[model samples]
Target: MRFRHPDGSIVHLAYCTNVHPAEDLDGVIAQLNGCSSLVRKELDVPVLGVGLWLANTLADRLANSSDALNRLKQALARNNLEVVTLNGFPYAGFHDRVVGKKVYLPDWTESARLDYTLDLVKVLADLLPDDASYGSISTLPLAWRVPWSRTRDAAARDAFNRLENRLAQVEATTGRRIRVAIEPEPGCVLEMIPQAAHWLTPYSGRSLIGLCLDTCHLAVQFEQPVDAFAVLARAGVEVVKSQVSAALQIADPSDPAARELLAEFAEPKFLHQTREYGGPGVDDLDLVGELSGHASWRVHFHVPVHAAPRPPLTSTTDVLDESLRHLVGGAHPLTHHLESETYTWSVLPSAPKNQQELAEGIAGELAWLRGRLVGLGLEEIK
Candidate 1:
């Protein structure tokens, strides 16, 4: 939440919590408060903003809208946390419907969805103080829910139109010009940087509709950090929010080599003969094979199963640093939240080392980022 420059100056840094450990309001607030305390004490900086996950928290509290809004307001006020931006929302409600079917006819007309989305935005906008800024509410492409093969130019155009129309309503209702960040995800219609740029061509020059560059998603698309940033800049797409993450590209466990090896050990013929003779058949052979192969493949492709004092060849630090540099060096002033969204952290073998690792990893990233930002003449928090 804060960073210090080499010159000994301090500045407030903003970020979000992607790992949701709490489902209740009190629990969520406690987590936020704890994070804020660490930022204030350890980082020695003020908390500028926080990102909210709408799907898990807000959606559940929908029936108690007034109470939910009040609780959110109280949480922010108590922790001295300001709303930087909100990601998953309005769109997440129809996630299953959109992704399950290859079409995104939003169950409502463009006007209807626009009104509904805006109404929700208004409630969130009202939650923030007059001087506070709200970052992008997600603007999902219709094709995001649909399959890639089914996403044609005509469908894309219609989707874009619907998005633009709804965004306009959001702007009107909020009475605050919030950016509608179009996030790119793997397998979604806007999977690649080029695809996202192409879709944003009409609104690229506009500030209202922008892009949210999520590193993990981009990694999945095999986009290099520098190249991805360049594409956004070239397209004149404003990055409303930025996330940091690493991808784990594991080999398929059911590949030929793995299958053959499993077959060799289990030997289907042996199992059949044993079954006929009422002998001890293979004990859950499928489960054994799956577990063994998965374990083997995980160790084969990812970083070493153990941690090293020095950085490993497979460490994602370099790419993450490059991404931070790209943002720090960009012309547009970086607003919103710089979320440490390494969601796959638990999947990594080094995750069980306790809170020290979590704290150290986050602090290390912030330290590296601060150095870059300070080099760019941005004031750092002490």
Candidate 2:
């Protein structure tokens, strides 16, 4: 899970644990024992990096009790696992029956979202590796695009001010700096790189606030990876972390069977923001909404990067490859943390039938991404 970039920087690769959603602290511990152990063994490495996802209940426990925190640390050490990053996007109940828009609840305008993220910062500070000087947490972009206003922007600014103060306190006390990376999705207020740049211009040089670039989201919007990276760099926006993920792309959107093929993934679990590639941009609520579109479409659903489900239903792995090349193949690398995040493993149309198969799929993705990095003139260090 450790690699030496051509720039002489050590980058850590991890697979996001949000794929295995847990309800409480005990469930999370179970994952470290069951899933994490399996993945480490599959990789056949002495140590593996895991980007953990802590729900509200588990985070609250770790933040309040030193014993719980120590238990988690011990678990990680026992399983030859380490954590330099976390998926703090989902606050609560991520595995419910229907998590449609509730994932955006308690937006930045509310104090709850700020409190949850602050808690994550505290936990990440404790869980960082010995040689690590910093950690990362990827959060939701401001909020859902609808029901947004200029007044909400002011509220968001206030929240950021509070978070900045807290981050300073953490760094001053622990000497471990943690940055909160706001991840941009399709229908969020800061969907594309331009919108993210416009809102983040004010916090130009602030190290605690930056963007978490997800390749799947960019591909869904039809924005070329190199073009997006150029825009971010030109805007002085730093990418604190990058999620190596792939989205579902349709070759022919006008075909009715293609719509049916995409519909099989439209479960009641999460939001699938579907988009079409006309001369202009096309938007729809979900994949089912784009069934009538005549142009090509891509869905926000994260799929396995190593393989496609079937013909006419391919993945956006090419975009992910290009993004990684731009990020690390330069004279200077963008970020030191790369996490493979395919959280929709269980919800995929032709997903693995069992837990062992799921672990194999995730390990395969991490290996595939590692190979991609190695092919770019980087060396994998055991």
Candidate 3:
């Protein structure tokens, strides 16, 4: 889906395909022909923009072989799907049964991360629509907070500097500009918007690296979206993209049912960083026990943007709304890319029964978000 901003720039609304477990190229192609097509049809849109998630191996293949790239591009065109951005956070093994901390492996402090990002750049440059102004990729926030040293910090900065130069070179070669959005999560080296803005202060001159504000993570940290955006603007940090999402909120952790519900969401699949409403937080749900039970708690679980959980267990869609107001409703557009990134479908307490059900759930989310964007004065391009 595409929306026209008041400034005449096109805002792309896409759903990240990282939710699907398709690492191999064939599986991805099947998805384009199957669920993706269904989603486009369900939305009744002529062109559907997708936030593509390519496995490292698949990215290498596409970047290295023009024939392979053309095949993937043709698959998308055949399915009426378009690409404007890529989710670069999970390198590989995203669908693993236990991907708690491994998702942060090979962080920006290492060369492997740089290699993978460049591959994504090459693939995205060709896949993006000719009318699309730019492409965005969201990555991890440097590395895990712990086990990081000055040397590692220096290395991460150096990696980003090199990434900027390489991105510029790619723009020169492809005539397409692709920017990287450093996604900060709870307990990461750079967690909050203020810290991320401070870290990004030096790169104000570099237009390729910016922040990808995930509403789930932002709400979990209790950062008001209005204030968060103000800080980023003051730091001159570009909001390249926003994962339009919501987080699970426990109104009162003391309630026995809510606590039990937490365990249900505590599967070994992903890390669920839990935070008290306006107090201290825990890095992972494993430490959720440490949080005081006297107040509301928000988990880093990406809930559907449109729906909250059962009664008494609300979602952070309220926070999501605030972010949307600034990102979409403002007179001028601050970010041109918005992605529905609820990748926790299978882990939900009420997980979809089948692929068709999953497609319906995803389409529901996009529809809800589309209505919200339309309400914000964004013209949905049919």
Q: Of the candidates shown, which would achieve the greatest lDDT relative to the real structure? A: 3
Name the candidate, 2 or 3, with the larger TM-score value.
3
Note the residue pairs that clash in candidate 1.
1-13, 3-381, 4-381, 10-380, 10-381, 10-382, 11-380, 11-381
The TM-score ranking, best first, is 3, 2, 1
Instruction: Give the Cα lDDT of each candidate.
Output: 0.50, 0.86, 0.90
| lDDT of model 1 at position 178 | 58
Q: Tens digits of per-residue lDDT for model 2 on 14-60? A: 99998887868788888989888888899888889999999877888
Candidate 1 lDDT over residue span 212-311, tens digit each: 7766555444568878877777888777766654433224444665444333333221111011011122222333332433322211111211222121
TM-score of candidate 2 on Cα atoms, chains taken together: 0.96
- List ranges where model 2 is wrong by over 4 Å: 279-292
Highest-scoring model, TM-score: 3
Query: Model 2 — which ten-residue stretch has the worst lDDT?
Result: 279-288
Error of 3 at 224 (Å): 0.9
User: Residue by residue across 1-382, what tens digits does model 3's lDDT show?
Assistant: 9888777889999999998999988899999899889888888899888899988889889999998888898999999999989999999999998898899988988888999999999889888888888999999999989899989999999999898998999889889999999998998999999999998888885778899999999999988988998899888999999999999899889999888777777777998888997689887777888888888899899988776788668899999888999987887888999999999999998999988888888999999998898888889887
How many residue pairs clash in model 2? Answer: 0
Q: Rank the candidates by lDDT, best first.
A: 3, 2, 1
What C-alpha root-mean-square deviation, in Å, does candidate 1 show against the real structure? 10.5
TM-scores for the candidates: 0.65, 0.96, 0.98
Clashes (candidate 3): 1
